[model samples]
Target: MESDLPIRKIIHVDMDAYYASVAQLDDPSLVGKPIAVGGGGTRGVISAASYEARTFGVRSAMSGALAKKLCPELIFVRTNFERYQELSEKIRAIFFEYTDLVEPLSLDEAYLDVTVNKKGNPSASMIAAEIREKIKARTGLNASAGISINKFIAKVASDINKPNGQKTVAPEDVLPFLETLDIKKFYGVGKVMKEKMYRHGIYTGADLKKKSVAFLQEHFGKSGAYYYDIVRGIHHSQVKPERTRKSLAAERTFSENISSEIFMLERLENIALEVERRLKKSKVAGRTITLKIKYRDFTLQTRSKTLPLYISSKELIMENVKDLLYQDEMRDSVRLLGISMSNLNNENPKKTKDISEKIIDVQLKLDF
Candidate 1:
């Protein structure tokens, strides 16, 4: 239940590589080594990788065959989703110790409306720090946190530091930070809107601030108002514990999970471009991008990257995704390709107010 309070404090917490990291932590030898949780042949796809495997280009969603090509020594493991769910529930229980206003996005991420809490902590930052420490100690996993006056800033803050990291965004710094952020990184901005922003000279958040409410409304239609409010750091939406998610997606099964270098790149580029287009239309920014791959042997792998920034650019999206992909050692020929982005932008829409003076010297005759 929400507190009948003037201010609502929200914090976003995300575990780093929840599944893969967990597997690695359970097995110490896997540390500092490239390892995937899935992918063995034409029907298999990677589920996750150790940080070491990430460096070698093995990633979730790449054809097992392709992952093998990138990393010959890549090891594959199966996903124990049930175990992950158990851990997720354990973490959720910990969150409940502080506030009942907890909203889970997935097993690894959640938002906590801590405006009023059972623990009665006055400082959100303090609570965030304590939470991080508690999660680490309890789960043996690193979690990042964002603390702010609102959800958008809080989510963004969480990313500034990652892998057992935390950050706070005060009210005074919110607008400026949004202004300087990339257009694609804004909560409501994406590739197509970005193209429009580019044409309108709105590359950075600063540039976006230059747009007038009327102009933004004209281009973005109803969302322009949303853009307007966020730029000013105002959001009427509450930390909805039961808010219905606007979108849901699933994997695209391929005709064959064969791994051919040229074929995979072409498929990847197409998949990315398509997802990029969809994100633009909704004016949504997602914090997580999950890649799914299926190989010939009917094996599967899933890898995901949660961004500190809500992003909607083909380049930024693809860059992290590509990193996740190339982490695998080529084990067999790949036949499928897939991509998805979530954690949509949570920052307020920005509007740059130009303080530049319009000089009109009506009384200049006094100088004469």
Candidate 2:
């Protein structure tokens, strides 16, 4: 049976250790050495790690202390957001030269839909190569890309060849490629989920394919359906041009845990101020204010209150946050505090495609 779904060419371009790479590019002395961007202080968390540092198991989100233990000589560099934003714009400009269907996931990576591009390039793989070359020429940074028929496969393939490399999973190879993929390699399947899938006897995509949708849903809930479809190369998500901002937030991880309400209030004030500044800069207000608390033991808790009217000022945001904070007694010493605003006034409608409408079996012609 033939399906009516369109066979689109999607490319996922991800920079190689964006923050750490930028630091190395700016400083000649740091190249070829173990370097980590961010995670400077006692309680600091790593934002990015260079390939050199990664050799010693140093990774982003690892604590500064632990990273130091992993690689004693690892150089720690502070994050410079302004510099990162500047380079990100340069890369995105190059992406626009080929197609306007660019979706930036972060300052480091984005998804580009070039099924019908301005360059009239028939092969997405060729466009990806050109873009990587242009980025190297313009910014002196290496980028990796994954080209496939859908975003999920494209995203996963991008990591296959890392640090100045690219991979393209032609339409004909999608099913076989996924069948042999390790369950851990599936995008969105993290450590916890991987362990859960292991217990279910799903160690690979082929194992996942054997399970019935009803069995998957009964065990894994909503995400089970997603896993069932994706394992068979059946993702229908489109490459959105404009991803809406669902919420705005700011957070701080304290060097030392605090148990006193007075100290908590002090920390909340700073967080609220940052959130307000961000909200005002974006010209948006929110009716829901959520207080995120992370305890010393790493347990997380959230308290939220939604008002009838939208609020963007620091004073109003702090007012509701204080109420939520006092609404419950301290469970343990707090290690991190965050303020997030949701139900924003600037929410925009998103473009969506229904994967359930039909199954696509067209042979894609993406060449590598």
Per-residue lDDT of candidate 1, residues 88-205 (tens digit) = 9888888989877777888898988766667867677788888888888998888899887667767767777876788877655677777777877775576688888788777887
Q: Evaluated with lDDT, which candidate comes out highest?
A: 2
lDDT of 1 at 193: 85
List, residue by residue over 1-368, the lDDT tens digit for candidate 2.
Answer: 01246778899999999999999999989999999998988999999999999999999999999999999999999899889999999999999999888899998999998877789878999999999999999999999999998899999999999988999998888888998999999999999999999999999989998999999999999998999889888887887776778899999999899999999999999999989988997788999999999999999999999999999999999899999999999899999999999999867655455332222453445454
Estimated TM-score for each candidate: 0.62, 0.89
lDDT of each candidate versus the true structure: 0.72, 0.91
* Cα shift from native, residue 342, model 1 (Å): 21
Give one clash count per candidate, in the order shown: 64, 0
